[model samples]
Target: MAGTPSNEPNEAPSSGADSAISNEKNRILVSDLMGDEREVFLLFNGSEYRLRVTNNNKLILTK
Candidate 1:
């Protein structure tokens, strides 16, 4: 089968269309998550964490 599709788990996407679809659905802008704020709090599994934008414009996450 010279032109058959692959069902292999390790196969890369055949075209930009496949990658673009996944990128759009799974990606989020950092600006949207931290709008007009330098810090945001996140909670997971009954624990709290802090996400901060440093003065140097780098991100820091801490528990």
Candidate 2:
């Protein structure tokens, strides 16, 4: 084999709504928001809003 498999075999393709989410990883220094949760941040298409997912899969929106 010329390549190795992905560690995340369960990873699925993005949907139409998910496609609108920015694929880019953003490193944000959130001294205000950081506490004790895992976060998934995304930028939506044509919107300045930001998405934040927690370790518990909770959703958060910020401008």
Candidate 3:
């Protein structure tokens, strides 16, 4: 028998992020977290970094 529906009030699931989100940075990248794509930055200093979340749900970080 199916117990009370999961949506029962006062009985919600724990708060956490979905694994579907690409977390390769913590699982792959070994650099830095400069900023996201929507940020505005001038190309200067020793090196420039950029983070992009593509429409295909892909996370790309470049320097």
Candidate 4:
């Protein structure tokens, strides 16, 4: 049987939040995420997704 996912709302870390208290293993810098390129490919569940840093310095993820 499939398990029910949590219904809690996702929230961003507060300005005063402690980094140590958060999950560091899953954290990555934007530069690292882009990896010397404006666009990067992300693979999830056998599907491909594109992550891009827009010219305006915004992020966009597309399938």
User: In TM-score terms, which candidate is top?
Assistant: 1
Candidate 3 per-residue C-alpha lDDT over 10-57 given as tens digits, one digit per residue, 9 for 90 to 100: 533545565334443346442343343443333558777666666885
What lDDT score is found at residue 32 in candidate 2?
44
Clashing residue pairs, candidate 1?
Answer: none
Pairs in steric clash, model 3 = none
Instruction: Flag regions of model 1 displaced more than 4 Å.
Output: 1-16
lDDT of 2: 0.58
How do the residues 1-63 of candidate 2 rate in per-residue lDDT, one tens digit apiece? 437776665545777765545543344455446545445354578667655765686767787
Select the stronger candidate by lDDT from 3 and 4. 4
Best prediction by lDDT: 1
Pick out the ten consecutive residues of candidate 2 with the lowest summed lDDT.
Answer: 23-32
Q: Write the per-residue lDDT of candidate 4 for residues 1-63, one digit (tens) a residue.
A: 336567766557665557555757668998877778999999999999999988998999999
Q: What's the number of clashes in each of the models? A: 0, 0, 0, 0
Per-residue CA lDDT of model 1 for 1-63, tens digit only, reads 767777855545568787778768977787999999999999999999999999999999999
Candidate 2 residue runs with Cα over 4 Å from true position: 1-47
Global lDDT for candidate 3?
A: 0.51
Give candidate 1's TM-score.
0.65
Predicted structure 4: lDDT: 0.81
